[model samples]
Target: MDSQMNAPWSNCSIGYSCVKLFPPPMHTVPHSGEAQHRTSPGVEGRGRMKRGVQHRSNGRSARKTRPGSESGFEVAHDFGPAAESARHFDPARRGYTWGMIRFTLLSFLLAALLLAALTGCSRMRFVVDLVPADDGLTETVVHEDDDARWRSPKVALIDVTGLIADVRRPGLLTRGVNPVAEYVESLRRAEDDSRVKAIIVRINSPGGTVTASDVVYRETVRFRERSGKPVVVLMGDVAASGGYYLACAADRIVAHPTTVTGSIGVIMQTFNFSEGMRRIGIHADAIVSGEKKAAGSPFEPMEPEHRALLQNMVNEFYDNFITTVTTNRTGLSDEQINTITDGRVVTGRQAHELGLIDEVGDLYTAFDTAKELAGLPAARLVKYHRALQHVGSAYAESPTGSSSTQLNLMQLNLDGAAMHDQPNFFYLWDPTIFSAVR
Candidate 1:
């Protein structure tokens, strides 16, 4: 009997049932004539121990008897409550809930509606591509009356604002447009348009380099001769010195009642730091071929000859300014011109009384004058700009499109390195450095 109970078990027959079985502990030995049954702790036996059958904890019927069960019996194992809960769980139901399904359906519906709404809409070209090419400037209509006919005769509006220079003005992070080039280009554009009968040059500047101002003045005169179009000047807050020089090219000049004009002179500014350097125990020496080679240098004192030489140059440029004014302003007498040309600035009303400007009225007055000169009963006002430039109306700010900031301290612009890098002659109106003696 001991040998039979210790033997390996065989596969169950066709009529029998089978389950995994474990041998009892060595300490438990069963008597030969009786059958033995074992259970886990905390579980109680529900029925008598039979020789060839085993009971399950779930209360199922007893398994069929095995072929060798008379010698040994099978064991039925139960996992606890965890296995019981897993038996009835559904994985598919947990992953796709009702709320998640509704959200997904709503998203699909919204996308379909949006697509339907956009189906028949006309496609707009990207504005980036509408930018003008390098060869030409963009023309925009800033003002048009309700009754104005389309493509009627136009009066081009050109702006000359801020410091006028031929080279690009340096800014914080980038370089600005060359004022001279921009002015010339706008004139060319206006000249080519046959519909543009005339141009209104709006000037708001305190003057700039002498050569730059002269170049613009010459170009404005050339534009009028070639195009046969009348040019009118509209002065803004300040049009003095170089600004006045350019205004001389216009056929007629108009200024606002409060505009400041007429600073007809030239200036060359310099500083001497030799005294401060001497106090700091610093001395500078220079070897020159001539005594005047280093004239007007900041490191040295101004010699008597140096002073005389600079004064002579200032006088020559001043003479040129006086000539330009007298030739354009034929209404002014020689004595009156001499009086105001002493580097004095005057208001628009005062300038009109002195025969410096033609009229003392607002912008519309200038427009009406332009229309009468161009021989047009009704015309549209247009402005020229580059791509990405905003010129919504004739009164758009900074028409020169210069991004350079003029940081002034004691009436000196800090960003004006172009003026200070070397000794330059200017037709400028700077109160700190210049004063008029009546």
Candidate 2:
């Protein structure tokens, strides 16, 4: 006879169980790993035995049997609790158990209604991907009105997509806010939020102003220092010049193999468009309170007086930027840094060779680097993309967009108007920049 099973997993040996019914694919151990020693309990008479070792059943494992076994006739129980319980049919015929059925039906409906309401009430965490300039400027408010701030705490992914400069092509479309001011505000928020464990600064630009880049770097530094949260810079296609400068503040830096980076120098470029203007027949004039007031103006031929002044200013910023980089990246030889810092962009492989980058890989590697910096066992790699669901994009917290305003250009270029007697500048002007115009 086939004995009735009582225990949850007590059918013969594990060998027999596997033969009779194998564990699901998810539960099955792979054959390639180390071999494990195991025994079955069925062969050991129902005593505590190792798995896969055979054992037999005994009195210690007695299982109860169903009654009426002699004739093999099934036994029946008097389920009709009493005459009162027999009223089930009569109540059904009458369409209810008087007021009790109505009360039960009402209770069930109420419960179902509550369950449905609860479904809608469930709060979903939609990360608002807001920066500085985005849909936030609109008069309409989505998700929550009356509160100017995001309904939830925002964690930004700073994706510097192009050459960061005072003059930039306006983005045709984006999923989130782009304004540099928004980035500042987000940094403020991230610093305040204990929930934000780490920030992934995805830098993909050729770099921009010393001041703008420094703002991001400084705020990133402050966020880490104040909150003890790590900022990991993930270099994208081209994180050079100001891009790498900002990344220097990160606890760790990762870059794609093809990522162009390590411009680790500073630069100041004025068209000296005096020649270009002369060619175009457009003469411009400027008056200043001070002699060096319009030091780097492009319209006029660069005066010897202002040329040295502007060069000195650029030199000071270059030194500051270099200092910040050296402080952030330790163990690199000064000579190696100088080699890469000659205002030359290098690939990630070359960057690793020059010790400018930590790793050579892509987004997953960046996530891993951030995880390592944050000291997390394993963080959920989630993309914080903003959703512009509403027509006017009421979901945006700041529509400032990705780049800084021309008005704020002074803050970056002047660096508080601090200058040096002698200065060396970082250069990133393409050797063939004139070819673009041609």
Candidate 3:
């Protein structure tokens, strides 16, 4: 057969295409909910619906409703026979309910134990965490040890770390617990509650605003005078400045042997960054309403007279601190007090020798001291640790938050480790006490 005869005819038809393509037929169908606006028949005025504007019904009720929005009978009648199987005992839904049932049963079992607790099962003790707040934020950490015997419910461990404005400090203030106010209230509660035999204030602070310190100080003083409750103070790492101020409220203060205590002064610090700014050609144009208004501004050089005035203010606060301490620890000579308390960091032993602290011991010893001071029967030790809550501050702002968790002796968090560290106030160190030592 010839090649052309065997091949299809279309293969040789170069001028024409083999298959023909056609376009789809065009059509339009009416869609739901789209009604174009036009002038209503016979009505010339307000009857004409406006275009390019949303048509809202001014009628008292809805003119139309969607399937999902259908009301009354539609909701009841919509479900078919399929709903009958899924009503209650559907196998698909049983697992979740079964889990809930298990959880409820477990919870019920635990409830009896809690009921046992309510019925005076074990001597219930509350651990009141009173970590000082930083930047007005409290950082209180609670701990439970394996040796339950060491835990004391009667003893309230109030943390008075920084700025004793509230019961919440150094870390817990962020959660909104005020240590000072809490102290006053707790002391009152302890005084009234026959169950709370004694109170121990765990002082681990560098002090803060004088007003804040005074607020807590006044409470402690009131607690001692009015209640006559044995208020034993256990000094943490550094109970200097305002911390010591509050410790003065206690009948006896027991600090660790190496605990740094006794700043015994007030201080305020201001930074001068003008020189650094001038080096970078940065200038400050400050406008103020008063002459002394810009006194604390670091942009300008402080006037000599202004500096003298500020120093006088510091001196007054220092005098107040000295007077307060003298009233608490009477008979100590100026030289001796200055040597011990003159913004200097000293060991608990040194503080004891200097008559700053009454003894050197932990919270356990403080508890015993509290009983001794209270003159009560067999000092029952109780630990008060508050339940953890939404503490807002970060670790940087509140070091105690993280440090407090690790109560390990050798390897602990910074804040926990700080509990045994040295004195803390850099602003108050002066030539009188530290200069000779340096």
The CA lDDT of each predicted structure is: 0.74, 0.54, 0.55
C-alpha RMSD of candidate 3: 21.3
lDDT per residue, candidate 2, 1-438, as tens digits? Answer: 112223323333334224224331111111233332222333322223222222334323322223644422211111112322443435455555567788988997776677557645333333334665343321222222133244332233444544343332332233423334545655665566564567777776666556566777677777778888777788876788878887888878888889887766665555567887888798888978988888777678778988788877777887887787778788878798688767777889989888887888876676666666666554443233334432333222222233222224233332111111222233232333223223
- Of candidate 2, the 10-residue stretch with the lowest lDDT total is 72-81
Residues 1-438, candidate 1, lDDT per residue (tens digit)? 221122112111211111223322211213242645453344444233444444343354334433555644433333334344545765557666866898899997776666556643232222333543463478788886566789789999888987777776653223456788889989998999899999999998888889999999999999999999999999998899999999999999999989988889998877788999999999998899998999889889999999999999999999999889989889788789878899999999999989988998877788889999988888898887765566667787653543224444444453354665767889887564432211
lDDT of 2 at 58: 37
> What would the per-residue lDDT of candidate 3 be over residues 1-438, giving only the tens digit for each residue?
111121122122221122112111111111232332222244322222222222222211111223453321111011122233334444546678999999999997687578666654343323344875333222232322234233233444555544443334343223544555555655665666565556788876666556667777787888767766667888877777777887887878899997877777765455578888999999998898978877756678888877777778778878878878888887798789769656777889998989888988876677667766666545344333233323221111222331133334533223321222332222222222322222
Give the TM-score ranking, best first: 1, 3, 2
RMSD of candidates 1 onward, in order: 15.4, 24.9, 21.3
- Return whichever of 2 and 3 wins on TM-score: 3
Model 1 residue runs over 4 Å out of place are 1-136, 399-411, 432-438
